[model samples]
Target: MPEADSSTTPAIVLDGVSKAFGANVVLDEVSLTVRQRSIMVMLGPSGTGKSVLLRCLVGLLRPDKGRVMVFGEDVASLDAGVAKDRRQLFRIRRRFGMLFQDGALFDDMTVGENVAFPMRMHTSMSAAEIRASVDDKLRRVGLPKATSKFPSELSGGMRKRVAFARAIALEPDIVLCDEPSSGLDPVMAATLDELILELHKTLGMTFVVITHDTAEARTIADTIGLLSRGKLVTYGPTDEVLRSNHPALRQFFARSTEGPIQVL
Candidate 1:
Protein backbone atom coordinates (compact mmCIF):
# COMPACT_ATOMS: atom_id res chain seq x y z
CA MET A 1 0.00 0.00 0.00
CA PRO A 2 1.39 3.37 -1.04
CA GLU A 3 1.07 6.50 1.00
CA ALA A 4 -2.25 8.18 0.40
CA ASP A 5 -4.03 11.21 1.79
CA SER A 6 -5.65 10.24 5.08
CA SER A 7 -8.52 12.60 4.37
CA THR A 8 -9.52 10.56 1.34
CA THR A 9 -8.70 7.07 2.56
CA PRO A 10 -10.75 5.07 5.03
CA ALA A 11 -9.36 4.11 8.42
CA ILE A 12 -10.23 0.46 7.73
CA VAL A 13 -11.21 -1.40 4.56
CA LEU A 14 -12.06 -4.97 3.70
CA ASP A 15 -12.09 -6.01 0.05
CA GLY A 16 -13.64 -9.30 -1.04
CA VAL A 17 -12.82 -10.78 2.35
CA SER A 18 -13.73 -14.37 3.09
CA LYS A 19 -13.14 -16.77 5.97
CA ALA A 20 -14.15 -20.36 6.61
CA PHE A 21 -13.76 -23.10 9.16
CA GLY A 22 -13.73 -26.32 7.18
CA ALA A 23 -17.18 -26.51 5.59
CA ASN A 24 -18.67 -23.65 7.57
CA VAL A 25 -18.23 -20.34 5.77
CA VAL A 26 -18.13 -17.58 8.38
CA LEU A 27 -17.57 -14.70 6.02
CA ASP A 28 -17.85 -14.57 2.23
CA GLU A 29 -16.64 -11.82 -0.02
CA VAL A 30 -17.53 -9.25 2.65
CA SER A 31 -16.35 -5.81 1.67
CA LEU A 32 -16.78 -2.69 3.78
CA THR A 33 -15.18 0.67 4.56
CA VAL A 34 -15.00 2.42 7.93
CA ARG A 35 -14.48 6.13 7.67
CA GLN A 36 -11.97 7.96 9.85
CA ARG A 37 -13.05 9.10 13.32
CA SER A 38 -16.54 7.72 12.88
CA ILE A 39 -18.40 4.97 14.71
CA MET A 40 -19.26 2.03 12.43
CA VAL A 41 -21.53 -0.51 14.09
CA MET A 42 -21.76 -4.01 12.65
CA LEU A 43 -25.16 -5.54 13.51
CA GLY A 44 -26.10 -9.14 12.86
CA PRO A 45 -27.84 -12.15 14.29
CA SER A 46 -26.04 -14.75 16.39
CA GLY A 47 -23.60 -17.02 14.49
CA THR A 48 -23.52 -14.57 11.58
CA GLY A 49 -19.71 -14.13 11.69
CA LYS A 50 -19.69 -10.67 13.28
CA SER A 51 -16.91 -11.70 15.66
CA VAL A 52 -15.04 -13.34 12.76
CA LEU A 53 -15.08 -10.05 10.89
CA LEU A 54 -13.68 -8.26 13.95
CA ARG A 55 -10.86 -10.77 14.21
CA CYS A 56 -10.01 -10.28 10.56
CA LEU A 57 -9.93 -6.50 11.00
CA VAL A 58 -7.33 -6.86 13.78
CA GLY A 59 -5.35 -9.63 12.03
CA LEU A 60 -6.15 -12.20 14.72
CA LEU A 61 -7.62 -14.47 12.02
CA ARG A 62 -6.45 -14.39 8.43
CA PRO A 63 -9.12 -14.38 5.79
CA ASP A 64 -9.14 -17.19 3.26
CA LYS A 65 -9.20 -14.64 0.43
CA GLY A 66 -9.13 -10.91 -0.33
CA ARG A 67 -7.47 -8.15 1.68
CA VAL A 68 -7.79 -6.50 5.06
CA MET A 69 -6.36 -3.02 5.12
CA VAL A 70 -5.93 -0.75 8.10
CA PHE A 71 -4.34 2.67 7.98
CA GLY A 72 -3.28 1.99 4.36
CA GLU A 73 -1.42 -1.29 5.03
CA ASP A 74 -2.55 -4.70 3.83
CA VAL A 75 -2.71 -6.78 7.02
CA ALA A 76 -2.75 -10.05 5.13
CA SER A 77 0.65 -9.30 3.58
CA LEU A 78 3.29 -10.80 5.86
CA ASP A 79 7.03 -11.14 5.40
CA ALA A 80 8.39 -14.64 4.86
CA GLY A 81 10.89 -14.25 7.70
CA VAL A 82 9.39 -15.11 11.08
CA ALA A 83 10.87 -12.16 12.99
CA LYS A 84 9.84 -9.68 10.30
CA ASP A 85 6.34 -11.08 10.22
CA ARG A 86 6.00 -10.76 13.98
CA ARG A 87 7.22 -7.18 13.84
CA GLN A 88 4.75 -6.33 11.08
CA LEU A 89 1.93 -7.90 13.04
CA PHE A 90 2.88 -5.97 16.15
CA ARG A 91 2.92 -2.69 14.26
CA ILE A 92 -0.55 -3.33 12.90
CA ARG A 93 -1.96 -4.39 16.25
CA ARG A 94 -0.41 -1.46 18.07
CA ARG A 95 -2.65 0.81 16.06
CA PHE A 96 -5.76 -0.75 17.59
CA GLY A 97 -7.24 -1.25 21.05
CA MET A 98 -9.77 -4.01 21.58
CA LEU A 99 -12.41 -4.38 24.29
CA PHE A 100 -13.53 -7.95 24.20
CA GLN A 101 -16.97 -9.13 25.22
CA ASP A 102 -17.41 -9.86 28.95
CA GLY A 103 -14.61 -7.39 29.63
CA ALA A 104 -11.97 -10.22 29.50
CA LEU A 105 -10.18 -8.76 32.49
CA PHE A 106 -7.61 -10.72 34.38
CA ASP A 107 -9.12 -12.33 37.45
CA ASP A 108 -5.95 -11.82 39.45
CA MET A 109 -5.23 -8.22 38.59
CA THR A 110 -6.78 -5.20 40.21
CA VAL A 111 -8.67 -2.70 38.10
CA GLY A 112 -5.69 -0.33 38.06
CA GLU A 113 -3.28 -3.04 37.09
CA ASN A 114 -5.64 -4.22 34.37
CA VAL A 115 -5.71 -0.75 32.87
CA ALA A 116 -1.94 -0.45 33.27
CA PHE A 117 -1.25 -3.83 31.68
CA PRO A 118 -1.12 -2.53 28.13
CA MET A 119 1.13 0.41 28.94
CA ARG A 120 3.48 -1.89 30.82
CA MET A 121 3.64 -4.36 27.97
CA HIS A 122 3.90 -1.85 25.12
CA THR A 123 5.63 1.26 26.46
CA SER A 124 8.81 2.16 28.31
CA MET A 125 7.06 4.64 30.57
CA SER A 126 8.39 4.72 34.10
CA ALA A 127 6.39 3.56 37.11
CA ALA A 128 5.28 7.07 37.97
CA GLU A 129 4.10 7.73 34.41
CA ILE A 130 2.25 4.45 34.29
CA ARG A 131 0.47 5.16 37.56
CA ALA A 132 -0.52 8.61 36.34
CA SER A 133 -1.88 7.12 33.14
CA VAL A 134 -3.87 4.51 35.00
CA ASP A 135 -5.36 7.09 37.28
CA ASP A 136 -6.22 9.37 34.41
CA LYS A 137 -7.82 6.66 32.33
CA LEU A 138 -9.80 5.30 35.26
CA ARG A 139 -10.99 8.80 36.09
CA ARG A 140 -11.95 9.38 32.49
CA VAL A 141 -14.24 6.36 32.61
CA GLY A 142 -15.93 7.71 35.76
CA LEU A 143 -14.25 5.21 38.01
CA PRO A 144 -11.79 7.43 39.79
CA LYS A 145 -11.47 5.33 42.92
CA ALA A 146 -11.71 1.87 41.37
CA THR A 147 -7.97 1.31 41.16
CA SER A 148 -7.78 -1.16 44.04
CA LYS A 149 -10.90 -3.16 43.29
CA PHE A 150 -10.61 -6.56 41.69
CA PRO A 151 -12.64 -7.52 38.62
CA SER A 152 -14.65 -9.83 40.87
CA GLU A 153 -15.58 -6.89 43.06
CA LEU A 154 -17.00 -4.76 40.25
CA SER A 155 -20.42 -4.98 38.69
CA GLY A 156 -20.84 -5.95 35.04
CA GLY A 157 -21.16 -2.33 33.92
CA MET A 158 -18.11 -1.32 35.94
CA ARG A 159 -16.10 -4.17 34.52
CA LYS A 160 -16.96 -3.02 31.04
CA ARG A 161 -15.93 0.50 31.94
CA VAL A 162 -12.60 -0.79 33.22
CA ALA A 163 -12.13 -2.64 29.96
CA PHE A 164 -12.89 0.53 28.04
CA ALA A 165 -10.25 2.34 30.08
CA ARG A 166 -7.73 -0.37 29.26
CA ALA A 167 -8.58 -0.32 25.56
CA ILE A 168 -7.74 3.37 25.33
CA ALA A 169 -4.65 3.07 27.52
CA LEU A 170 -2.34 3.05 24.52
CA GLU A 171 -4.38 5.83 22.89
CA PRO A 172 -4.60 3.97 19.61
CA ASP A 173 -6.15 5.45 16.49
CA ILE A 174 -9.00 2.94 16.44
CA VAL A 175 -10.92 1.02 19.11
CA LEU A 176 -12.61 -2.31 18.35
CA CYS A 177 -15.43 -3.20 20.72
CA ASP A 178 -16.84 -6.73 20.63
CA GLU A 179 -20.37 -6.39 21.96
CA PRO A 180 -19.68 -3.59 24.41
CA SER A 181 -23.27 -3.56 25.52
CA SER A 182 -23.69 -7.31 25.86
CA GLY A 183 -24.81 -8.94 29.10
CA LEU A 184 -26.05 -5.71 30.57
CA ASP A 185 -29.50 -4.46 31.52
CA PRO A 186 -31.16 -1.88 29.32
CA VAL A 187 -30.13 1.06 31.53
CA MET A 188 -26.56 -0.17 31.80
CA ALA A 189 -26.35 -0.85 28.08
CA ALA A 190 -27.58 2.62 27.31
CA THR A 191 -25.06 4.02 29.77
CA LEU A 192 -22.27 2.15 27.99
CA ASP A 193 -23.47 3.55 24.68
CA GLU A 194 -23.32 7.07 26.06
CA LEU A 195 -19.81 6.50 27.32
CA ILE A 196 -18.74 5.20 23.91
CA LEU A 197 -20.16 8.25 22.17
CA GLU A 198 -18.58 10.57 24.73
CA LEU A 199 -15.18 8.97 24.37
CA HIS A 200 -15.42 9.02 20.57
CA LYS A 201 -16.16 12.73 20.59
CA THR A 202 -13.54 13.59 23.19
CA LEU A 203 -10.72 11.42 21.89
CA GLY A 204 -11.56 11.75 18.20
CA MET A 205 -10.72 8.13 17.47
CA THR A 206 -12.56 5.75 15.17
CA PHE A 207 -14.68 2.96 16.71
CA VAL A 208 -16.07 -0.27 15.29
CA VAL A 209 -18.66 -1.93 17.51
CA ILE A 210 -20.16 -5.37 16.97
CA THR A 211 -23.65 -5.97 18.32
CA HIS A 212 -27.02 -7.61 17.63
CA ASP A 213 -28.99 -4.78 19.21
CA THR A 214 -30.75 -2.57 16.68
CA ALA A 215 -31.43 0.19 19.21
CA GLU A 216 -27.79 0.26 20.23
CA ALA A 217 -26.73 0.33 16.58
CA ARG A 218 -28.97 3.32 15.95
CA THR A 219 -27.59 5.02 19.03
CA ILE A 220 -23.93 4.82 18.04
CA ALA A 221 -23.54 4.00 14.36
CA ASP A 222 -22.69 6.67 11.83
CA THR A 223 -22.85 3.80 9.38
CA ILE A 224 -24.39 0.38 9.89
CA GLY A 225 -23.29 -2.86 8.29
CA LEU A 226 -25.73 -5.73 8.65
CA LEU A 227 -24.32 -9.24 8.28
CA SER A 228 -26.31 -12.43 7.79
CA ARG A 229 -25.25 -15.97 6.89
CA GLY A 230 -21.67 -14.95 5.97
CA LYS A 231 -22.60 -11.98 3.77
CA LEU A 232 -23.09 -8.25 4.20
CA VAL A 233 -26.82 -7.95 3.72
CA THR A 234 -26.90 -4.19 3.97
CA TYR A 235 -24.36 -1.37 4.43
CA GLY A 236 -25.24 2.29 4.63
CA PRO A 237 -26.29 5.10 6.93
CA THR A 238 -28.38 3.95 9.87
CA ASP A 239 -31.71 5.30 8.69
CA GLU A 240 -31.18 4.01 5.17
CA VAL A 241 -30.42 0.52 6.34
CA LEU A 242 -33.42 0.53 8.71
CA ARG A 243 -35.57 1.58 5.77
CA SER A 244 -34.23 -1.11 3.46
CA ASN A 245 -36.64 -3.50 1.77
CA HIS A 246 -34.21 -6.42 1.74
CA PRO A 247 -36.04 -9.42 3.16
CA ALA A 248 -33.34 -10.44 5.57
CA LEU A 249 -32.78 -6.88 6.74
CA ARG A 250 -36.48 -6.34 7.26
CA GLN A 251 -36.72 -9.51 9.31
CA PHE A 252 -33.71 -8.50 11.40
CA PHE A 253 -34.78 -4.92 12.21
CA ALA A 254 -38.39 -5.80 12.81
CA ARG A 255 -37.40 -8.81 14.90
CA SER A 256 -40.03 -10.64 12.91
CA THR A 257 -40.20 -14.42 12.78
CA GLU A 258 -42.07 -14.62 9.46
CA GLY A 259 -39.38 -13.54 7.01
CA PRO A 260 -36.31 -14.80 5.12
CA ILE A 261 -34.19 -14.95 8.29
CA GLN A 262 -35.19 -18.30 9.69
CA VAL A 263 -34.71 -18.79 13.40
CA LEU A 264 -33.07 -22.13 13.69
Candidate 2:
Protein backbone atom coordinates (compact mmCIF):
# COMPACT_ATOMS: atom_id res chain seq x y z
CA MET A 1 0.00 0.00 0.00
CA PRO A 2 1.23 3.50 -0.92
CA GLU A 3 0.13 7.07 -0.29
CA ALA A 4 -2.73 7.98 -2.63
CA ASP A 5 -3.36 11.38 -4.10
CA SER A 6 -6.88 12.70 -3.48
CA SER A 7 -6.64 16.00 -5.29
CA THR A 8 -5.63 17.27 -8.71
CA THR A 9 -7.01 19.66 -11.31
CA PRO A 10 -9.21 18.49 -14.13
CA ALA A 11 -7.12 16.50 -16.63
CA ILE A 12 -9.36 16.83 -19.68
CA VAL A 13 -12.22 19.13 -20.65
CA LEU A 14 -14.61 19.43 -23.60
CA ASP A 15 -17.01 22.27 -24.34
CA GLY A 16 -19.72 22.19 -26.98
CA VAL A 17 -17.74 19.71 -29.07
CA SER A 18 -19.20 18.37 -32.28
CA LYS A 19 -17.87 16.34 -35.24
CA ALA A 20 -19.22 14.99 -38.47
CA PHE A 21 -18.15 12.74 -41.31
CA GLY A 22 -19.91 13.42 -44.59
CA ALA A 23 -23.63 13.02 -43.91
CA ASN A 24 -23.12 11.34 -40.56
CA VAL A 25 -22.81 13.50 -37.46
CA VAL A 26 -20.76 11.90 -34.69
CA LEU A 27 -20.50 14.03 -31.55
CA ASP A 28 -23.13 16.69 -30.84
CA GLU A 29 -22.41 19.47 -28.40
CA VAL A 30 -20.65 17.05 -26.06
CA SER A 31 -19.44 18.82 -22.96
CA LEU A 32 -17.65 17.07 -20.10
CA THR A 33 -14.65 17.37 -17.83
CA VAL A 34 -12.58 14.53 -16.41
CA ARG A 35 -10.80 15.11 -13.11
CA GLN A 36 -7.18 14.17 -12.66
CA ARG A 37 -6.51 10.62 -11.45
CA SER A 38 -10.20 9.69 -11.60
CA ILE A 39 -11.70 7.01 -13.81
CA MET A 40 -14.58 8.38 -15.87
CA VAL A 41 -16.57 5.90 -17.90
CA MET A 42 -18.18 6.91 -21.18
CA LEU A 43 -21.12 4.57 -21.68
CA GLY A 44 -22.94 4.48 -24.96
CA PRO A 45 -24.24 2.10 -27.55
CA SER A 46 -22.17 1.26 -30.64
CA GLY A 47 -21.82 4.06 -33.22
CA THR A 48 -22.78 6.68 -30.63
CA GLY A 49 -19.45 8.56 -31.04
CA LYS A 50 -17.82 7.33 -27.86
CA SER A 51 -14.61 6.61 -29.74
CA VAL A 52 -14.88 9.91 -31.57
CA LEU A 53 -15.09 11.74 -28.28
CA LEU A 54 -12.06 9.89 -26.93
CA ARG A 55 -10.04 10.81 -30.01
CA CYS A 56 -10.99 14.45 -29.68
CA LEU A 57 -9.93 14.48 -26.03
CA VAL A 58 -6.43 13.42 -27.08
CA GLY A 59 -6.22 15.97 -29.94
CA LEU A 60 -6.13 13.21 -32.47
CA LEU A 61 -9.40 14.31 -34.08
CA ARG A 62 -10.23 17.97 -34.38
CA PRO A 63 -13.86 18.76 -33.66
CA ASP A 64 -15.90 20.83 -36.06
CA LYS A 65 -16.89 23.11 -33.17
CA GLY A 66 -15.90 23.79 -29.54
CA ARG A 67 -12.73 23.25 -27.59
CA VAL A 68 -10.72 20.33 -26.17
CA MET A 69 -8.44 21.22 -23.34
CA VAL A 70 -5.86 18.77 -22.01
CA PHE A 71 -4.02 19.58 -18.80
CA GLY A 72 -5.56 23.07 -18.99
CA GLU A 73 -4.08 23.69 -22.46
CA ASP A 74 -6.49 24.06 -25.32
CA VAL A 75 -5.15 21.23 -27.50
CA ALA A 76 -7.60 22.16 -30.21
CA SER A 77 -5.91 25.57 -30.40
CA LEU A 78 -2.46 24.20 -31.19
CA ASP A 79 -1.89 24.82 -34.87
CA ALA A 80 -0.88 22.07 -37.32
CA GLY A 81 2.51 23.85 -37.54
CA VAL A 82 3.27 22.60 -34.01
CA ALA A 83 4.07 19.15 -35.36
CA LYS A 84 6.85 20.57 -37.55
CA ASP A 85 9.22 19.90 -34.69
CA ARG A 86 9.62 16.22 -33.85
CA ARG A 87 10.47 17.15 -30.27
CA GLN A 88 7.21 19.06 -29.92
CA LEU A 89 5.19 16.15 -31.19
CA PHE A 90 7.02 13.77 -28.84
CA ARG A 91 6.44 16.03 -25.87
CA ILE A 92 2.76 16.45 -26.67
CA ARG A 93 2.18 12.75 -27.30
CA ARG A 94 3.88 11.81 -24.01
CA ARG A 95 1.16 13.36 -21.87
CA PHE A 96 -1.43 10.73 -22.84
CA GLY A 97 -1.56 7.08 -23.87
CA MET A 98 -4.36 5.44 -25.80
CA LEU A 99 -5.24 1.75 -25.67
CA PHE A 100 -7.45 0.87 -28.57
CA GLN A 101 -9.82 -2.07 -28.99
CA ASP A 102 -8.35 -5.47 -30.03
CA GLY A 103 -4.98 -4.57 -28.49
CA ALA A 104 -3.88 -2.86 -31.75
CA LEU A 105 -0.50 -4.53 -31.62
CA PHE A 106 1.47 -5.02 -34.77
CA ASP A 107 1.15 -8.63 -35.87
CA ASP A 108 4.75 -8.63 -37.14
CA MET A 109 6.25 -7.35 -33.92
CA THR A 110 7.05 -9.36 -30.79
CA VAL A 111 5.36 -8.30 -27.57
CA GLY A 112 8.59 -6.83 -26.23
CA GLU A 113 9.11 -4.95 -29.46
CA ASN A 114 5.57 -3.66 -29.37
CA VAL A 115 5.97 -2.49 -25.82
CA ALA A 116 9.33 -0.84 -26.41
CA PHE A 117 8.41 0.75 -29.72
CA PRO A 118 7.37 4.05 -28.22
CA MET A 119 10.49 4.30 -26.09
CA ARG A 120 12.61 3.62 -29.11
CA MET A 121 10.86 6.25 -31.17
CA HIS A 122 10.61 8.97 -28.54
CA THR A 123 13.54 8.53 -26.15
CA SER A 124 17.29 8.36 -26.62
CA MET A 125 17.51 5.56 -24.02
CA SER A 126 19.98 2.78 -24.54
CA ALA A 127 18.93 -0.79 -25.27
CA ALA A 128 19.32 -1.74 -21.61
CA GLU A 129 17.19 1.19 -20.45
CA ILE A 130 14.46 0.40 -22.96
CA ARG A 131 14.52 -3.27 -21.98
CA ALA A 132 14.22 -2.41 -18.29
CA SER A 133 11.31 -0.05 -18.88
CA VAL A 134 9.47 -2.52 -21.09
CA ASP A 135 9.98 -5.35 -18.63
CA ASP A 136 8.78 -3.29 -15.69
CA LYS A 137 5.62 -2.15 -17.48
CA LEU A 138 4.86 -5.69 -18.66
CA ARG A 139 5.30 -6.94 -15.10
CA ARG A 140 2.85 -4.31 -13.89
CA VAL A 141 0.28 -5.64 -16.34
CA GLY A 142 1.02 -9.23 -15.17
CA LEU A 143 2.64 -10.28 -18.44
CA PRO A 144 6.36 -10.36 -17.75
CA LYS A 145 6.93 -13.68 -19.47
CA ALA A 146 4.81 -13.03 -22.53
CA THR A 147 7.31 -10.55 -23.89
CA SER A 148 8.87 -13.18 -26.12
CA LYS A 149 5.50 -14.21 -27.52
CA PHE A 150 4.05 -12.71 -30.67
CA PRO A 151 0.64 -11.06 -30.69
CA SER A 152 -0.78 -13.87 -32.80
CA GLU A 153 0.30 -16.41 -30.19
CA LEU A 154 -1.06 -14.65 -27.13
CA SER A 155 -4.63 -14.90 -25.83
CA GLY A 156 -6.95 -11.94 -26.26
CA GLY A 157 -6.77 -11.01 -22.59
CA MET A 158 -3.00 -11.39 -22.57
CA ARG A 159 -2.73 -9.18 -25.64
CA LYS A 160 -4.79 -6.57 -23.88
CA ARG A 161 -2.56 -6.73 -20.85
CA VAL A 162 0.43 -6.25 -23.06
CA ALA A 163 -1.26 -3.31 -24.69
CA PHE A 164 -1.93 -1.81 -21.28
CA ALA A 165 1.69 -2.31 -20.34
CA ARG A 166 2.81 -0.52 -23.48
CA ALA A 167 0.39 2.35 -22.98
CA ILE A 168 1.73 3.07 -19.49
CA ALA A 169 5.40 2.55 -20.30
CA LEU A 170 5.71 6.28 -20.88
CA GLU A 171 4.15 6.97 -17.47
CA PRO A 172 1.49 9.06 -19.17
CA ASP A 173 -0.61 11.30 -16.95
CA ILE A 174 -3.80 10.42 -18.79
CA VAL A 175 -4.92 7.12 -20.30
CA LEU A 176 -7.73 6.68 -22.79
CA CYS A 177 -9.16 3.23 -23.36
CA ASP A 178 -11.71 2.27 -26.00
CA GLU A 179 -13.78 -0.85 -25.33
CA PRO A 180 -11.25 -2.37 -22.95
CA SER A 181 -13.46 -5.31 -22.02
CA SER A 182 -14.31 -6.31 -25.53
CA GLY A 183 -14.04 -10.02 -26.47
CA LEU A 184 -13.48 -11.14 -22.89
CA ASP A 185 -15.62 -13.47 -20.82
CA PRO A 186 -17.50 -12.08 -17.82
CA VAL A 187 -14.86 -13.31 -15.38
CA MET A 188 -11.98 -12.09 -17.53
CA ALA A 189 -13.66 -8.73 -18.09
CA ALA A 190 -14.14 -8.35 -14.34
CA THR A 191 -10.52 -9.28 -13.81
CA LEU A 192 -9.42 -6.61 -16.30
CA ASP A 193 -11.60 -4.09 -14.49
CA GLU A 194 -9.86 -4.97 -11.24
CA LEU A 195 -6.50 -4.56 -12.95
CA ILE A 196 -7.53 -1.13 -14.19
CA LEU A 197 -8.63 -0.15 -10.69
CA GLU A 198 -5.34 -1.38 -9.30
CA LEU A 199 -3.43 0.68 -11.85
CA HIS A 200 -5.51 3.76 -11.01
CA LYS A 201 -4.57 3.38 -7.36
CA THR A 202 -0.91 2.64 -7.99
CA LEU A 203 -0.12 5.07 -10.81
CA GLY A 204 -2.28 8.07 -9.93
CA MET A 205 -3.16 8.49 -13.60
CA THR A 206 -6.30 10.02 -15.07
CA PHE A 207 -8.40 7.47 -16.98
CA VAL A 208 -11.15 8.01 -19.52
CA VAL A 209 -12.71 4.69 -20.46
CA ILE A 210 -15.21 4.46 -23.30
CA THR A 211 -17.14 1.31 -22.62
CA HIS A 212 -20.66 -0.03 -22.93
CA ASP A 213 -20.07 -2.37 -19.97
CA THR A 214 -22.40 -1.04 -17.28
CA ALA A 215 -21.30 -3.73 -14.85
CA GLU A 216 -17.64 -2.92 -15.47
CA ALA A 217 -18.28 0.84 -15.14
CA ARG A 218 -20.16 0.27 -11.87
CA THR A 219 -17.15 -1.49 -10.46
CA ILE A 220 -14.42 0.92 -11.56
CA ALA A 221 -15.77 4.36 -12.46
CA ASP A 222 -15.92 7.33 -10.12
CA THR A 223 -18.30 8.99 -12.60
CA ILE A 224 -20.10 7.90 -15.74
CA GLY A 225 -21.31 9.61 -18.91
CA LEU A 226 -23.98 8.04 -21.09
CA LEU A 227 -24.06 8.99 -24.78
CA SER A 228 -26.84 8.51 -27.27
CA ARG A 229 -27.23 9.75 -30.85
CA GLY A 230 -24.07 11.81 -30.47
CA LYS A 231 -25.43 13.52 -27.39
CA LEU A 232 -24.66 13.06 -23.72
CA VAL A 233 -27.98 11.84 -22.40
CA THR A 234 -26.83 11.46 -18.80
CA TYR A 235 -23.74 12.19 -16.75
CA GLY A 236 -23.12 11.80 -13.01
CA PRO A 237 -21.61 9.62 -10.34
CA THR A 238 -21.64 5.93 -11.07
CA ASP A 239 -24.38 4.99 -8.65
CA GLU A 240 -26.56 7.94 -9.59
CA VAL A 241 -26.30 7.34 -13.33
CA LEU A 242 -26.90 3.62 -13.04
CA ARG A 243 -29.83 3.86 -10.65
CA SER A 244 -31.65 6.66 -12.45
CA ASN A 245 -35.14 6.02 -13.86
CA HIS A 246 -34.94 8.32 -16.88
CA PRO A 247 -36.49 6.64 -19.92
CA ALA A 248 -33.25 6.55 -21.85
CA LEU A 249 -31.36 5.48 -18.74
CA ARG A 250 -33.83 2.68 -18.15
CA GLN A 251 -33.41 1.48 -21.73
CA PHE A 252 -29.63 1.51 -21.36
CA PHE A 253 -29.78 -0.41 -18.09
CA ALA A 254 -32.22 -2.94 -19.44
CA ARG A 255 -30.09 -3.34 -22.61
CA SER A 256 -33.38 -3.52 -24.45
CA THR A 257 -34.01 -3.31 -28.20
CA GLU A 258 -37.14 -1.16 -27.92
CA GLY A 259 -35.47 1.84 -26.35
CA PRO A 260 -34.37 5.20 -27.69
CA ILE A 261 -31.42 3.60 -29.49
CA GLN A 262 -31.96 2.24 -32.97
CA VAL A 263 -29.47 0.37 -35.13
CA LEU A 264 -29.23 0.66 -38.87
**Which model scores highest in lDDT?**
1
Per-prediction backbone clash count: 0, 0
Q: Candidate 1: minimum summed lDDT over ten consecutive residues — where?
A: 1-10
Model 2 lDDT-worst window of ten: 1-10
Residue-level lDDT of model 1, residues 1-264, one tens digit each, is 456336657889899999999999999999989888899999788888988898888888889999988978888675435788879878889989999876899989999999999999999999999999999989877799999999999998889989989999999889999998787788878877887888789888889999888889889999888888899988988778777767887777788888867666
What are the runs in model 2 whose C-alpha is more than 4 Å off? 1-8, 81-90
lDDT of each: 0.87, 0.82
TM-scores, each model vs. reference? 0.93, 0.90
After superposition on all CA atoms, what RMSD does each candidate show versus the true structure?
2.0, 3.7
Model 1 clashes, total count: 0
lDDT score of model 1? 0.87
- Model 2 clash pairs are none
Residue-level error in angstroms, candidate 2, position 84: 6.0
What value does the lDDT take at residue 119 in candidate 2?
87
